[model samples]
Target: MLKSILLFSLICLTLLTSKAQSVQWASKVMSFSSEYSDPLLGKEYRAIHILGRPSKYPKFSATPSAWQSLTPDNPGGEFIIVSFDTAKVVKQVAIFENFGAGSITRVDALDENNKLYLLKEFNAGYAQANGQITRIRLANPTSFKVKSIKITMNSLRVSGYSQLDAVVISDGDSPIEDRIKLEVDPNAYLVKENLGTAINSKFNEICPVVSPDGKKLYFTRWKHPDNLGANKNQDIWVSNLKDKKQWEKATLFPAPINNEENNAVCGISPNGKTMLLNNVYGKDGQMEKGVSLSFLLRTGEWSFPKPIRIQNFKNKSEYSEYTLAPNGKVLLMTTEMKDSYGGKDIYVSFLKSDDTWTEPKNIGAAVNTGESESTPFIAPDGQTMYFSSSGHVGYGNNDIFLTRRLDDSWLNWSIPENVGPVVNTNQWDGYFTVSAQGDYAYFSSVENSMGAEDIYRIKIPEKVKPQTLVQVSGQVINQLSKLAIPAKILVKSRVSSDTMQIDYDPYLGDFSFMWPTKKPFYMEIRAKGFVTRRENFDFRDQAKYFESVQLLGLVPIEMNKQYKVPNLSFIQSKSEISKESYPALDEIVLILQENEGLHLLVEGHTDNQGDWDENLKLSLERANQVKSYLISKGISVNRIDTKGWGGTKPLNTSTLEEKRRLNRRVEFSFFVVQ
Candidate 1:
């Protein structure tokens, strides 16, 4: 009898192993439903935990521990349903009952048509074990493939809820090895091209940063003989656009920018005048690493690099790489800070009024994952961001992803989309930057390259193209001397209320600003001993990609001299101020506050578009509107007087609409009333 029992046991085990190997299991879950879930173990785990591997520890439980089993709130008449992305011929089902094992009484399978088939029914005779796999073979295997499984549990003897550690299923057609292989879509297309010998050398090149003007490319090359340092370390190199698609031969940046120590170009300002470099220099027999800021002088030479001191960024590991937006008010960086979800997460810091950086905030999970994220690049538009991540599901090891800022809060972001295979591969891919026009993307790659790493350019896909931004660049000069004036340029957007202050190049008088969206903008130029100059930019129908040249000449403030307020627009034939006129009016309020002892006259003029009587009344009401705004700004009304010149004082006598538009203006003259 003993010999017969041993032979029967061996036969049963052989049949079980053969059946398990004959079927393929589903890899992805499509739907999960549970009648009730334990408060500690949420519904997600209660229904989907069976798809993952079993935990090693069965007796001990902890929050977020994989070993914890899924339990229902109520034990009687409870059910758990789980559906897979694809239908499979499930021949065997196994359940690991680590806790509350006796609560499960029956199991059923469902086909694609939602028709359920009974699989097994348990009785009190069934024995429960701690962390034991109980395999249930269907007595009458269904002819159709199964798409989902439903487990029902009911118990009267035990008041505790039903618990499950894991569930395993075996399909009838595919083996485990075939099921584990990942499938790549054959329809996906990604095309990459080399940047050519002019920009890439036999040595390693990486971290490409394109200037906002899209005429210059700056990058880091390692172990090159042209490096100033004898240590064969990294050095900064630059290449200028020679033609449409051709670049001049790469050359090392002038001294001080690329020293003997290891130096790498982190980023370049939108104007291409400020460069952020990472320098690893030795001091007191120890290596020191920090980011240094180098400004391009008016003489075409870089100033001595000064190390940037971030308030809380003390350790070297806290920051890995960073990029500055075109406006220089926002900084995007990759760091291994404590708040990071995993490896290296991206964070952003805003420039405070005192010129200090605010505390860096993590960009949130929509862009970060449990893997490393690095090499962030904010486009000129400032809304879209490109970065490399190993955490997000992508084509390869490290794929580039793009996301747009959803709101004013830095933490709010849209779901990150993979840039696609054309720019991403199974190998590491990152450090992506786009041109000012959002037409081409610049990045470093190792494939089909002249060196370990080479810079490459490719036309950006329309879907991922960043929103276009307009570069407003011009000169600030003195009206009297007709020479460059060192002044402060203040820009404010009427719609967004975004403000930026930039100082003109003291020697060159050149200043540049970036407008990220199509909105009205107000600009003010202030210089010592000069009347503040104000201008407006109306971008209602502005081209998506182009630069606007604005030349501002500041006049000396004098008595009985009138200065035209460039951008004050009123509703047609009415005194109501247009939304676009707020910035200019705000500037007038600032001027009044600064010149407290000065008495001013607010004059309103209108084009010869309407009846003379209506024009006169509209102009007077417009001037009163100005006075009312000034009073609202805490200015004393007695110091201001209003006058309506109407069509009598037209700046331009031409009949053209454009000339008439220019004639409609508001002029203010200041005088010292003793």
Candidate 2:
């Protein structure tokens, strides 16, 4: 069974005096009879996890790192002993059951000097449906000073493992309630700011999707006169970032963008040429139940939004949402399918080779709970994802949290971290968007409102913002003509299998990659009649917030033309290849493998600083190594040749290290083998 959210949250306390005292949570987990095994939270339900405050929702958890029994019963007896730092004369004990509500059968207080006092023995009824705290009222306070509390639970009454998030003991017979507060890192909490009257009216504005380039803001407005639904339903609106500071006056999207139904923007491409809009808008202005795509026409008008196909697409919930990946190859949506974990779980559907969406798959327990998870947005950096979930521990209602995609598998995600209470209120909070800058983030909130849930912005706290990444941007250029060429770039990461393919505008010849600076990556830039140029990029050592600019030059694959290998590097003054250079070499092997008749000569060169004799020998060794490695991959030896020009060839005569590094490279020359 899927271990779910909170059930019973447990805490023990003793009355100090007639004066009302603060509630005390379990300060330490002394021992547990048994524990459940849950790999979803990326951790075990250790007894130590039960110490301190409750970190999950109200429902009983198989885990949110809470203590769950191995079976409903712990053979000898199922119980956990928790202690507080200070002992007090106690009266009432309140148990917080996040999961398996009312499963706790008994409560015992441990006094100083070794006396265990009975608090109350519960009947073990599954009272609450989700997570609820039950209070054990006592007529008289304890006479002795109590330092610890013991909880005994029965798994039989609860169905499965009863999860415990925390236990609270209060003094003076007051009710003990441990409210959840996100622990934002010090100095890492962003101050939320309202977007003001220019964008927000007394109506409603929600679901803000920031453009990848960070210049435009797309959102949904409700009950506004400009809305196409005649102020009856929601419509999509947009605002431009004027001078990088203020947002220009909001304007409702003209026809095709705003329809009679609930219209909104789910995703947008970096160039703002294509958008994944909510629902399919037909020619007659009526809408369907699925998502659609609209293209920006050359005339600066949006084309009609047409429905996109998703195999077996079904949403049980009335509300459905989606966000397109920066590359447009992946899409995330919130829906309830037959296999949904609960009310609404976040699912992913990939854009297939045939242009149809594959069936949506559950993203797993890491992000979804028995509750709802919605309004997903992937930052332009590609890995960081922000969404609102009631399943994870947060303030009341829905709260926005950020989690990163760990690997190529959408299932592997870092534990979702709350975005803090600044922007997330006790009310509904969702629709988070970030740009390539990874600095500022925007969301919608009902508080500090112009009317409805107004749009808000915050300087992303460094702790919760997308990891610092370099925005690799440039245009494809012809090596011979020195002119821009419309091109396509297939970017592959050295560490992840997630390959993002992007196209440069045919007119501008420009493309960009919002790549994490911590990882090494290489890209294949291809255009008609041109040799696919492979360039390696590693900005791992670059400081935070540092973005790089590069010009990718491509050459026509013609006779006697030599193209330099990119991202390939050898250890300083050595012929041995750095492991980082393997991917670049593999690219060459791939090109050759694709063209069976292609033969190649690998030439190695050294910087002018190196001694001629030593550089000559070192360069030759490097070229031979490349050839040998290729042969190991089953390439024919007769089809390969090698040479070295130590300091004899220089891309430039500059003395700076940045420029000097250009001369230290391997170059590829191709010939058609008869």
Candidate 3:
């Protein structure tokens, strides 16, 4: 009797399992055209959104997942191919089109081997009006089984965009209920892509650091024969973003930067001129446990890595990582110390005036957990911080998390949130870095790597992306020589009062920095045998700027020569000062104040469109306005002079309105007040 009852129980269990498995949905999206790049958008437009149960029709389509093909979006063809997890005898198949309907012209069913033999075609179908829960059932109680389905849609048939919410399959012909239970898929977007052979080798490639321009990529390669330390230690390798947007073949750096000991790139300045390395390099190519900087020299080669001394710098752990903030004022390190909360914690050190860094301060418990926290990277915006930890709740052994600084104190930060399941993983996902644009995040992954580990990058949603920043570049020119000047550029934020110094590349007289502020930012350019020039870029009113570029010219500071003030106040030929001119005038005032021995001459010019006498009078009034402004800011009135060139001294001979407008300008001249 017991044996009979056990057999009956086994039969019942098999039946239940089969019944549960019979209700299968489109498990995967194989091919799609005109899909949204970001998973959050293109409701019904993204083909991947149809992976599970139907979304019970679209009320407001954007609120739920749906697929939409761009209208006139992809010219030649429009189609989607979806496959199921299990092939079962199908009683009915449903296509849920909630929004712009009747784009479907044909549907095909494939067998287990992807052989398309069964299909249904519609004749000259036009778009139908939007309907609630529009379920089009095809092939009910069919003779054979199906593994996948293909859908062909035409936006031309539909006057507007078409939407597809879900494609479901059931073993029985009866319609699927609205509340049918479906399998939960939390980490849906696990699109693990390999960075390809150009960056990955049979060995391990980790610690990715992409340049701000998004053109250069740097990573650490270990256990490779080409490594300087050979298999035992890792060395830095670089690749260029070539034509077709593919990364070029990676090449290893030689001696100076990569010695026999382990060498890695902890940070790269936005200008691509400075790099922070993992270990301190000796003049003789020997290395020690410390941090160093390798600069791009005038010869176009990397300079020997020089140690950057930090007060009371010590790491209890053999493995440690560090990052230099884009502003060049802060250094982030992940190390174990006596005061660490646990295995490892994130700490910050600030750059001092003496070219050294202050002692490391713990980042606080909000970000660094009781478990290890490694690989900290602060975005160009400075507020958003990314780090990896095993202690935080995540989908992997080690995952990357992003947090924002709440106030001036770096200790106060929002609770760390996992970047996402796709970016993080079941295995270790760290050494993450982003370009200034913050569109793609480059990271190291061991899974599917060409060798032990490989570098990969993925498009991130805009919500988590770093705040948009402007890329500002300029050259430091000598007053007399008219040649490029290698100088110390003092960059400061008026809002945060944060100051940092960056070196100008003398060879090209070129310098670059990221501008993340929506307020006044100043750059004080200083070079040997030349006067200092201060430049201010005010973005207070124009907060809409994003991923923009600004090119600045030479620092004009010759004794008797004139430099255009570039104040836009005279653009309308009006004497009333615009707020745009305030920053420019402030910059001049700062330069004068910094050099107490300097006296100033303010000159204004106007276009030839107006009468010479009136233009001259207006110009003089403008110069007086500037002088009065300077005096209001504490400049001595006795040391300043005013002049007006007017229409007689037009810069351009052209009669065009635009060219004539260039004559209306303000200029500054400096001399020693003897």
Candidate 4:
């Protein structure tokens, strides 16, 4: 009896599952309201396409030409009301139309009780010149049991007729949740707050870039009265953060940075000292544009913008918009290059050792589609990328999407996910940037706002926030003169050997670098006429967000001058040097090679802990060990001399272990010997 009852229960469960799997389809539309129908073809064309029937003239309809064209009585807006035989829960609707003529701009639906509901409104710029199909997902999935759909078309152009090739309605009653979810959960509260009137104006304000310190906000304001181009071009504007929530009134960037040309701010480095600006101008009767770089001088003035010449950017068609990764090692840009799925796609190029860019590679299909993708912003973590795409299934045209690098390769990426309705609306939404902390995102939107486009800030959802990043920053100065020097800063990943090189501000001596957390890095600071500085950072156990400030001081290369090697280490009490000491020794080898006429004396010292005689012997051996390593690196042995001073010259007399450790060291003194 128990077995019979169990079998009956199993049978009932299978029946219920099968019943749930049954997906219903709406019957063909009984009628449609049209202003003027073709004499040869009736309204049957609309119902036939919705019913998945083949077009009567498949060859001629390649450009979304309809079997019957509906013309409004006058040159204005018109609607086509498509009614179905039975009410169906519509999950999504795909509308096919001609690209060159009047197109559908809005859609509304009527429920079984004749109650109408507005569905979605497309932006004026949403349509392309090529015949294409747009899929509009209903905002409320549960409220889609509608009997009719009204597609409204605004005849903004001279064309009097709006042609509809087909309409497809996807029923949401299917047991499988294959449809793209559009509506946000009721409990999910995400609001996009305007930056307010202080920074936004009646003119267009876009491309917001917040400094890593979160103190300054920079953006581009177009058609402002203060613009140098008679309110026709764009200029960079900046505002300071007040109490974290409010912004001071924005002021136009001064002369050199904002000129008569169309100047716009694209990106700001993590240190807030370097900025990437787009300069658009007309040359030879054609518009020419490129991204220029500028530095913030110590005198609170911006340097003149200089065009960044990428070695591999010979093909102008492939490169459009670009942003530097926080580390400045990689450049993420939009390209219409070959092998792209279609239209403009996001690509990446790495900075090579020769200060040139590598050939750009597409970020892959997971993040791109047959439609256009643009405005890419790589977060400080370096792995997370936010961009805009019309190809992906999104809320509407050019919705913002985020994707993460799955691995070290540019092509390996996670599937792109829409950032959702809080940040993306039905209109054009793009140019998104996030703060270094990953808490708030700043982007331009065309919603109810102060201008045609205004900058807005929204708190990012915790789940969508970027991974943590750590910044390494400081000033590079001359040790003896205590004056700022122009230097090249190189940060290299110990594991991957990937390197990022940035130039320090010559006037300010300030430099900053950002990298994803939990990696070991080696940094080298090099400048002419001075000894280079090298340091290492191990952040495997560091907290999520970390900032390391290091003052890199360089000693001027003078005859008979001695400088302590910062990181040369010896094994406990042995003469053997640690492998971690190689980077420091390599700098010496580089200095010797660069200055062929120089001679070096390697001096080693010990703390005041061991026997005098033994310490002397050990220090001599350690000095010779470093000398031998330099010889192995092709430095002439005759150019180097070694010496040892036991405990006679201790750096620190403190009894603390950490203080005493600093007393044991290796020093290199160089002189010109003709």
Candidate 5:
């Protein structure tokens, strides 16, 4: 049994000490009756069912003798108040009558003035004759709007009583079209060639499947011009998108796919790693009544197609096609169901971690109607669903419908709409599959064709469409000298830690990668000659055209040393002269500027070397030599502190030339946060 789980919706709440904002309904009631005579309100009013019982109608028409209200046990007439607000349009209307099939005379939607605006009175099916529920669908009804809906009843030839147990009215809206947008100007390129002959051979052509990186395209061709098989034969063919925009002449996809039997390619994984197609064959080894589902693997040399056993394939007439999610776990399919709305509805089955398929479940009434719905394809994000519906409102035949997944449930599904004059005419418009980037829409259409439905491509506008990726790019460079540096850069998402690493060309010093554009990420770089650096980039807050490039200056580890040198020099005036010591102090200034984190304590010392008081004064003077150079080079004084240790502490306890040299040296250590 399929599990029926109740859904919890995310609700926005506002707290209030007193009774917060809320609605108070006087009461809830459902009124169901079978009679079509008088209008209840204006032309807009059809049948009114108020929340609470109101005063009786001024002139209530006699209830038809054949009409009766239904409850839980009687099987049809239980009407539930799904909502009490005004509705603009009713997409579908369902009713249950007691008399078995062919029991009702007619069902019509009338205005409050008793004028019929729309009607759908079809022959009662087997289920309807036996007191089962019957669903009636109307074409787009935008000509008039109403708050109430009326259902008129008429008995069969032998005028008998008509009973209604429940009435369900569905709110309707038009389905949204696939939107595709170009990142750059459209003048950037044009279709060098359509390569229609690749898949067009005087037979029906369709289902163009493009590879992940936008390199290869796989499509279905029938009665292929290059085939040795009989006429009306079908085969899978592939074409390459060379030089970015040009599609190479298409050819039969490698073996095991272009078999003697009719093989139709349905969809391909974005990565081009797997393909799903359906094949029909019989004992004669040609197109037959028996159609088997299979998958093709791109194992270096394309492997033979393998059959799928998803527990739902029960008959030769049962149809099934695979729609692979970008992540490769969700598989959307179609099959005839005993409990289906009508002929067929799309279903989804998830692949478990153990590699087994789960039981398939209907996409539910939100997307599937009682009429046949099939050809399911999910956008790369796995949030938007696109399919074809014959029962949906459109220009003609099958029209495309799209619905988005919200929270854990799919809701707010737009009604199916015609793709306009370009993609649809009076024929079937389906078997649609789109690229991850949402740039191109490929489907079977009979447009400027040599024969039956030829594969056609349309560009999806960007504003309201889906996208496959977010691009990130930046430069590596020396922080202090402002020079570009080439290094290995790795971008890791804080949540997933999935790393996309790229090495900058030693000369170019630039790197970039296409990161999934929905999260926070950090970039880190490591170089052999410099310090490791890291930067954080939050894509969530970035603009649509965001890009980043950074420069890092690596600090070289300096050695601690002891040295004897000439007395630090002071030039010109007595208070501001240190000419001889300038070169050595300049080197220290460069080091500090290169490594921003570096801080140093400058101490002055005299060679064992002098009178206590006189040495102290001289030591201070030498320390000033280092400080002045740093100040001239933009180094903040707060970062450098000076102290004098005059002749007090000596090195090596010796008075030799070497001892004096050691005692006269300068020293500094690194101070920085980890």
Candidate 6:
């Protein structure tokens, strides 16, 4: 009876769990087309390839000239809604062309009061005859707050531009959401954000990954005033939110997890048990900021960092900055591969079941180029990949790009769309991360910053999001030469040599390291032309301005002679040297030159490579070789006494090889006081 009751209870739990997985958020429309076919395969591949298109495209009809409205005033104008608890959070509306022509003259986004928030006027006289997706941004949009949005277009009156065709609308959750929306989405989701106790002294935080139970939040804070000491920089910080509505101010995460150095976090796994961070603990006990990053994992109250294996390290070089997937199994970081798309491509390493990292593979040509691609953020669905790219066609420098996984590949990308006017500016914008639910995004920028660089929180307009990360950095330059040598730098445990290890960029000579505020670690760097540098750092107890410049150069090997001479003795009182002393003949010649005008008795000794008489004869011959070399170097023949003793002197007696090798050596002593 007890067993039956337990089985029933387990079944009840299964049903409850399965019911929770039914919830899902609407996905954005992404498409592509092959209107311009391959010039090489015309007749063989006749059908036009379909680029991903919105579901609202009209059905093809036999009548090519059917009457359809394309203006914003048209009832079917393109629109999409982000919903929470069956209510609208925000709506993104598109109205240009679905299957026809459209030259957009002016685009405006309106709120409930019909007030304009975005008024973009464009002269698209060169718009193609093919359909295009027009984006609109909405404000304060909530699960029920955002009512509706409109898109207006003006048709060009010239033959150069195509005629405006139709408009369409969709209903779902916002393309981007926040912690609250994500938790309430399909499944048992938990998304956390920054809640500060202080207002503006120095409030910087991001990448808040919550545990599956939704009790803890792990994040990173940089340049906070409390963290400003003689060596303080960036460190991992954490907080807990009790209940769904209450959040506490963050505190320095536990010890053995942090060091007196800079630690920046990049990605966190769903369980919150492990996360990836970049750390720069210099060999001189200094924390490096802005260019060296590595990975770390958390266990109980302690978080430890271990360097990526087989990553090359020289005398002093840097290579640690990277991103992590939600599962903690896919690592996306910058590296130099021979066939790289460009500057720094985002390569991925999958964690195999055997606990070893798979060989890193590049994301390939579709999303990468000869330009820099970095800071990859993979959404929970494991399909929507967000990253920053500089070479892809976009509106500004280093624009953020989004791509959908098509079957097994990611070639089907939305024609790189700018995050519109609100999120993008003329300056640099990269290094961005998002909540699991796809609502809110965190990024670092100087646009409206209070200092050199500050982190910012943005409630994205429903249709777009900023790039995944804003690169925070400085570079390593030669102190004496002031020129950068793309060297490889390393960070390891001075105690066990098993902790975090990473390599530096050979191309840029830069590094980006992130870590937790839990443990103290030792940093060491080695390169081809410099001495190994060492430093100690504790994140749990940090210092301020954790920055340093390491000056290093090649170390030369020193040659001196408090040199050990061979045990040259007579064999059983016989005066002769062993044969093994021949190798030391060169040293006797060196001794004569080093001490000019000095005379020497070349004594050879043997512990017993053979019997007494045989050892003595061999030692004699060995001693003569020394006398000959000295004479060859222009030393006076009468100033040298070549003598040998075999089996008479012993350094050690366990074996003949060791004793003979030691005793059958050439020695130079005072034959005549010089």
Find the candidate with the highest TM-score and give its number: 2
Ranking by lDDT: 2, 3, 4, 1, 5, 6
Could you tell me the TM-score of candidate 4? 0.64
Tens digits of per-residue lDDT for model 5 on 1-674?
10011101111122332433222111222334422332321111112222211111111111121223332123232222212234345555554342432444345443434344555655443342344445655676535543444443323322333333333444332210001110223331143113466546577777667664556778877775665466646677778887866677777765656667667776665434456667543344545322233433323555555544455544212566667665455677766555444456667776665666676677664555534667777765455666776543343456555555553333334333234444444467776666655567666766456678777776754433554454455566666666676677666777763555565653532444545457577776665545455566766654343334444455434433322223443321222434655545554565576667766666666665546787777667666666676788899877776667766765556767655655654444445545
**Candidate number that wins on TM-score, 1 or 5:** 1
Q: How close is each model in CA RMSD to the real structure?
A: 12.6, 9.3, 19.3, 14.4, 17.9, 22.2
Q: Write the residue-wise lDDT of candidate 3 on 1-674 in tens digits.
A: 00000111001122233344355668688888776543321122356555554432323232124566755334465788888877767766677676766777777788888788556665555435563343445555556678888888766765656667667776754555332322123553356567888889888898898888888899998877877754468888999998877899999876688777788998888888889899888776677787888888767788888888989988877777888877777888887776665566788888888988999898775665445789888877777888887654455667777777787657777766667656766688898788887677888877667768778888865546776677777676665556666677888887886666777765744577777756478887765434556677776654432443433334545676787785544765687677777877876777777667778889988888767788889999889989988999999898799998777887898988778778878887888755
Tell how far residue 84 is off in model 1, in angstroms. Answer: 16
Error of 5 at 401 (Å): 2.1
- For each predicted model, how many residue pairs clash, with residues at least 3 apart or on different chains? 4, 34, 8, 0, 30, 116
User: Where does candidate 1 clash, by residue pair?
Assistant: 23-171, 23-172, 24-171, 190-422
The candidate that wins on lDDT is 2
Over 4 Å off in model 3, which ranges?
1-190, 229-232, 476-506, 517-674
> Which ranges in model 4 have alpha carbons more than 4 Å from their true place?
1-183, 186-190, 224-226, 280-287, 311-319, 352-356, 477-488, 525-533, 538-548, 552-578, 602-628, 641-674
- The estimated TM-scores of all candidates read 0.66, 0.67, 0.58, 0.64, 0.48, 0.36
lDDT of 2 by residue, 446-477 (tens): 86577679898988777677767777777888
Which of 2 and 5 is the better model by lDDT?
A: 2
Local error of candidate 5 at 243, Å? 2.6
User: Candidates ranked by TM-score, best first?
Assistant: 2, 1, 4, 3, 5, 6
- What is the C-alpha local distance difference test score of candidate 1? 0.68
